[model samples]
Target: MAANILTDPGLMPELRRVDHGFFGPDSVAWRVWTHPSILIGLQRAVAVQFLNPFFTAAHDDAQAIYKYPGHFYDMTLGFLLSGILGDSRTALQTSDFIMRIHTRATGIEPISGRRYHANNPETQLFTHIDGWQSMLKCYEVFGPGPLSPADDHRFWNECATAAELFTCKPDDIPRSRDGVREYYATLRPQLCVTEAALSGMRQLLATSGPNSTAKLAAFSRFATPATLITLPSWMRRLIGFDQPAAVDRAYLPFMRGLLGTLNKSKRATRTTVRLAAPISGRILRQHWAAGTPRRAEVATVAEARKLYRQELRDENGFSSDTEYTAAH
Candidate 1:
């Protein structure tokens, strides 16, 4: 997401390894989720979650969720980026961090007459399925997808396997494309726009905050409209988003142009996870030592920068004598 970490020094680990985690360099989920166009897929997933009544209600009441909504979105994106491309150890650490966060997201639901927790298996299942569908769906629409029917099936199956790596239930995983379609169909009756969902969606799409730089802010603006336009028409209607005929007519060409831009540079999209280890291990151990008494250590920006560069060289696969010769 931040300028081809696949090739960046000081930020990327050895990422061509095949055994890093669940979906390796060879897996379709990795291929699908790591691409630049995954931006659209992730945006789709964020928009779709509000249709869940319980999630909508909980999110509406949680002020922390709104105060920095864009940051919240970016944090999730970072988690996914670091997890998916990171080696086995890094992936595990990020997963643990996310799970710990989810455990705290519990609340009572007035409508369903049940308690809602972000880490609840059922809720996790819902989010996973929606997220999975949105990623694959948008890839097919906006990226180099619409895979051969065989690869398409493999994509969905690989995603199921990826899901199992997290907190997914074996019984709830959709192991095939048809299973995903059937699952969504079954949930259709339950999907509706609550006042909370509507309000959140509005704000979510309205603007990027002041903290975003101009370039990031512009992309943030394009992201909402493009993602909304890219979602299935039935979904747009289901969630009470309207697509005027004129907007639809204009958006298709714009999407085609945008997708063309993505297509033009395949090198930028190539990202991989290392087979043998985690990329973030050193960063976590040295700087973010969660349990260490030395956590209070702080430094000026210049010291921090020097320390980071040294750490990157030391832990990210290079000797002190080899910095100039090593190619990312």
Candidate 2:
């Protein structure tokens, strides 16, 4: 078995860098995210995230998802992994890019007759927590064994730290598994199914987005079912992703085998990254070229964020931090 290009710096020289960014190698985030199976989790979250009508509407209006599903998926995953694995500078730049994207994704939501903004704390928090939940859920069931109780708690706690990359404050993110469930339960009643949401979900599940090759579509036959089974039946039904229990039973082993191979085989991981590179986001591509820090220097989210701010200030010739913030 070869090493994963994303994790082993020996393969991805760019991964070799000094700063560990927000989460260190020992953190639960790095532990789970480095696994190949988390890619499934990310795909699953792409569908699940649209369960929010506002999010779906915003995405639909932006013409990012339905119009360009494969691009949307790859770009989202690219930015996400960059934030997790890139050094402090890359992560902060990725976050700023996301913020700009969110800023422009604002409009009247057709269903509720209310305006929707992607950066709204409620929306951002939902996306942030749901993504973490999806990643960890898939990682446990298929990638690696489940975390211990303490580690499980730490995963959720660390999720808050990761949330700093987005608009959400740490306090807004759930610190426990139960807190996540409670947050979802509270948000469930407000979630409504819309045609845009269903259409976007179908596009994602089919992998039939613009510029998606036939090979990718063929792979989606196996990958989509695996992605669907990761979601709970209720949520699946809510978003019209209905995979039978028998399908789940039949595909579970294959999914596990496929992901396990990717986790272990360097050639497989490298191939996957190469396939995804065409649609990768700018920050992720830049990070790949520039590489991360070589030394494992850990920094708190706040401290790392200040570095980003300082760099931004220097680049733009902002006279003060306040001016930098305002300009941004």
Candidate 3:
């Protein structure tokens, strides 16, 4: 098969990063990512991170392939998956690699008159928090269904623990959906999407669909419009995703309905989730074949996705309950 070159390693790794953390298979974060509509929150989290101007300044527009939305799905999933599922040693390596990369991500924010470093704990905290919030948003709206407020509180607490790897203190993070709402209340004063940020956004969106042929890539491109519908009015305005309010209102229901129906099938949804990489690879190949003329090399998506699926299966095993938790 075309994906075998990437999955040539015969067996899955035995160790896991979350074996001792609250984010273990029993956690809500696990439940959120394994859901049929996992991609929904994952994409939204990427968009939400850019709402912070300092974070936005870190994206280099010239590196369209790297900064492109087509690539966002894998990159984001890798970050979370490494921390959430990789062995402790691998997880630490991944964290350190990111910190080292961010060390060079220092820049001046023209609008805020502030210097920003991707490694900055507070900045990283904003990203961690936003991601947790987005995960919950997608799971509630697209996955199995809405979780209880009490469960939401427990989920947020667990998320904070996992996110502590990024420097979030337990108290500094929200503990419930309402707390997330309040957390955003505080950030309203500090957040604004500037033209430079908007340009960075454009770089991402412009490459959204044309860059890959993987079904997941196509799904991501399709989700872009619906994800935009979910973005806060302020965030949408910042990036200039100006569809009429009526359009957004119409999109939300249709997307929710589509994803909900898919959630009804355990086999189909799991297959889609597991195929993220091959889908991404197919997307890339399609782009090259269709006159996109790739300028640089991207590590094989099939291989990356193969490893991810192996780890996920090893951790959770094959369970029927779509909401089934991996035995810790």
Candidate 4:
């Protein structure tokens, strides 16, 4: 995408050996993230992300997505995949790459004249939490049904761990469903749809495979409403994504059937990879290529960070961002 953005850091060998980089293989994060249906949540999360006028304003000013939509998605998906599935080094570096990009995304909101920076902890926190919530909620609804209460708690706690990559303190993130609801409650009053945000939302929903083939176009058609229906009715209405209540009711069964059949066929994950390749392929494809190792060391995010900390030292002779790699 961006000329400075290095999609591959040549860490797949290490990534392949990592039994558990940050979240363990046994983690609720892995259980939820590995599902093909998580794409629905990711799509809807982008819509919700645009609801924050400031956040939308920052992105609108940057226009990175507008300039290079295909590369933009590829990088987004890459960051998500590497952070979730990569080794400590890969995950940490990918997070840094994203934050570095954010540092340049700054502008003043047109409506309130308030300054906005993508690196702001508040905006980053909203994005982090919304994405986790959307993916898990979508999985519960469309994929395998609800998780155990204990597992849900674990998932949210793991979300906090992942927040280390963002400007937010991991401790400030919610660790339970009730906590998340309360977190959003405080922000709800601050959120409103703006014309710019509405346009951005529509554009994000319209994304398709790079080829724009018929099948992919049809999938995009189905996916837009599918993601819209997953939003809370209030959110849907507020964002102008509301559908007829009857359509909402009817689509649920159809989606459940479609996603269920795919999951059962064991082709869902592979299909997701293929579909994502055109627009956003490298990171996910790399992760898929790495595959799961049967035996290797597992480490907590903190532990893994410490393990890789020395690897990133500038004195260690790594180049600047363009060629930085965990491999030495």
lDDT of 4 by residue, 1-328 (tens): 2221145445444554555567766889877776767667777787899888888898788775566654555566557766877777667766766665566578898878989887788888899999899988888888889999999889998899888867777988998989999988999998999988987776677754343445444555667778977788789889887778888789888888887776664345656645744323344445556666554665676776566655543423344644342221
lDDT of 1 by residue, 1-328 (tens): 1222322435444332223444444667666765556666666787888888877766776744367654556555555655554444444444444554565577887678788776666666888788878877777777775777777777776566545435666557776778888998998888888777887776566544554345445555676667887777888887777668787678767776776575555432332111111222222222112232222232222333234444443444344444312221
| Backbone collisions counted per model | 1, 8, 7, 1
lDDT of 1: 0.58
lDDT for each candidate structure: 0.58, 0.71, 0.57, 0.71
Identify the runs in model 2 with alpha carbons over 4 angstroms from their true place.
1-18, 276-295, 313-328
Quote model 2's TM-score.
Answer: 0.85
Stretches of model 3 off by over 4 angstroms after superposition: 1-21, 61-69, 87-89, 206-217, 264-267, 270-328
List model 3 lDDT by residue over 1-328, tens digit each.
1111112222123223123222443566656655555566766776677678777777652343354454455555655655554444334434444444455567787776788777677787788888777777777765556897777877887776666456446678877777888988988888777776666554444333455555644565677777776677877876786678787778878878877776676555545555664332332222123221122221222333334444443332323333122111
What TM-score would every model get versus the actual structure?
A: 0.72, 0.85, 0.71, 0.85
Model 1 misplaced regions, further than 4 Å: 1-19, 208-217, 266-328
Ranking by TM-score: 2, 4, 1, 3
Structural RMSD, model 1? 12.8
Which structure is stronger by lDDT: 1 or 2?
2
Give the lowest summed-lDDT range of ten residues in model 1. 271-280
RMSD per model, one decimal:
12.8, 5.4, 12.3, 4.4
What is the lDDT, from 0 to 100, of the residue 107 in candidate 1? 83
Q: What lDDT score is found at residue 244 in candidate 3?
A: 84
